[model samples]
Target: MGSVTTKKHQNGLDYVEVSTDLCQARIFLQGAQIDQFTPTGKAPLLWVSAADDYQVGNGIRGGIPVCWPWFGMSGNGGFPQHGFARTRLWSLDSINMHDEIVDLIFSLKLTEQDRQYWPHDTEVKVLFTLSDTLSVSIVNKNNANYPVSLTQALHTYLPINDIHQLSATGFDGSKYIEFGEGPYQQPNDKVNFDKETDRVYTDLSPVQHLHTPTGIIEVSRENSQSAVLWNPWIEKSTRLSRFKADDYLTMVCLEAANVLDDKVTLSPGETHTLTTHIRWV
Candidate 1:
């Protein structure tokens, strides 16, 4: 019913290949990043940039980039932005094939080298359940005696027919922190990209729908308290590495995150899982 394979991807990165009657997917061992997923009888749902070179140790412009330990710049002046998970290679722990679905477990442990940034004993893993729909479960377990506080995000880039015409419905009356700064606004209409849009929203809405000319796409999550709506527009889009300046017109990111006031605190022996589910209609 399903199969798993391995292949050498861009710049010598290794990725696990999954194939089933219901869908096809590719998960890079580096950062456990998923670059592609297409369910049967549906249009391609995920988005990747045309300028992506897939260079080793560099985060691809699109796909699900797991930002862990910290989401944005931690202001340390020494740590890498979006943590080191996206640059480090993850170990594939297990893979199981069922009647019509496939499950793959990938693990990453905090190493001595990683301690210099935010020293904490931790274990991170993501379970990818791929079938007609895609579900990614990111689990963080704290091993340190003291409580560890951190922020993480599943940077999910979604494909749409057009960015200008796309409408995201769900946060009709919610407030958002624009560009990580203050003066959060409560939009009167659904999300529509007029220009550079980067906002972090709280209130923990459970479901969001991205409406395109073709159809409406559903994004659902569990155990997530924050969502990031982003489209680099012109200025930041041109500055982005491995991304075309005009690529934002075809893609938008609605990420599941726990940041700022929603930052997660995990005590010793405690674990937290943030999950995101995507489907197209």
Candidate 2:
């Protein structure tokens, strides 16, 4: 097994780096309060919802977070929800910091512990660069001399004063299979929120802007064909938590991901990478 360690910077921010020669990731706790997640740096890339009254499920909610090969309840995979990646500790490979940016790299490998669940020898690397723009890159390689299947994403939670006042672009005119609903449908070009919305959009071009009454955040992606936009709003977030009763009002989950039936496949010695960049305006 690999080891876990912590390193703090002069900027008053700290990171918990997890590693093995094969794979690695960083988890930031400061972003935890807001449900934002990051494998490195101070910002919450995504939010893993707390046990609160407003939560909808016990999964990642806010931040530019990681979502491995499979997510949610799976009858086919026979593995845990969201795969074994998030709960597993990742180690740091390298770090470079400056006044305006911080870059972090992490690595992990298939272990005896991990293989028992999903037997495969693979190398997963996550690179997070938080500069004037926050960028997250995930690369996976099939090292076992055989083909493998995986699903993944960088779940992001953007800050907003109100969920109703927010709207996102880029997924417009695209078709999606609603997570809570029955079938796939095309979302109107102009996005709007009225209920619990979970949908995976395929064949996305690139560059989408999430607009709020206050400001707009632009998300750009490469080699990512799918993106999931979700908000539990009033009723859904209530059941997923065990603690706070009002935590849902302040956050929402907008993930750049490949989930459900959409999986990434790699051949032996073959590697694939997904990258997302976030800029606040």
Candidate 3:
């Protein structure tokens, strides 16, 4: 079994690239927690952003970045937006390679620094495995002797040439809370975004599909209840320096998430796992 290690280059830049026989995938990582995602291979299939190169235009945030106790600004979470998982560095515990596949496990131990945001003693492990298919597993171990509530998501930004011509299936009959003044409740299944939108959908099956003009993207999840679909669209895109207003036509954020609105509880010493597997045809 071998592991992924880092070496600094003479350019004074430290970047992490996947070294694997699985040429279909590449895990581009950075020491800076807030740095946007980069794709070297199959990842580029996940997203190609016209706005910024570092930001993952449309691929799942490839590793398990915990979204503890809350999903966005919804009050249930006491920390800042989207939790603290993204802005922190995770320690690579081990890496194992077998045949043509590479598996890397990353762990983050809750410390006083994490307690400052939310008081909880937790051990989070993220396993990234690449083979013919790309998969991620998030394991949460609660060290406390009581129950803990958390909300989370695997935020995937999927690549697209034209968002207008694509449609998402699997959420059709599910319920969703619109993130706007209306805050309307609606069914899932097939959604077409005509205006600015942000909302969390509750009640999901194990699988969802994204159909584009080129091909179809199938997303399968385990122990996840929500799916998020996002595109900056027109007006919102104009406001973003990273994204041009019309650039929204090329990318979309399709996330498999468990929002605070629908919380998951784990008893003391209990462990919970969240998983998602992606494939396209």
Give me the candidate number with maximum lDDT.
1
Q: How close is candidate 1 to the true structure, as a TM-score?
A: 0.96
Whole-model Cα lDDT of every candidate shown, in order: 0.88, 0.62, 0.62
Which candidate's TM-score is highest?
A: 1
**TM-score winner, 1 or 3:** 1
The lowest-lDDT stretch of 10 consecutive residues in candidate 1 is 180-189
List clashing residue pairs in candidate 3.
58-157, 58-158, 59-157, 60-156, 171-188, 171-189, 172-188, 172-189
Query: Model 2, 8-47: lDDT tens per residue?
Result: 5344445565443323445543321113223232333333
RMSD of 3: 4.4
Segments in model 3 whose C-alpha atoms lie over 4 Å from true places: 1-15, 19-21, 28-43, 48-66, 74-78, 180-188
Displacement of the residue 25 alpha carbon in candidate 1, Å: 0.2
Cα RMSDs, all models: 1.3, 7.1, 4.4
Query: Where does candidate 1 clash, by residue pair?
Result: none
How do these models rank on TM-score, best leading? 1, 3, 2
Q: How many clashes in each candidate?
A: 0, 38, 8
What TM-score, computed on C-alpha atoms, does each candidate reach? 0.96, 0.77, 0.81
Candidate 3 weakest lDDT stretch, 10 residues: 31-40
lDDT score for residue 174 of model 1: 69
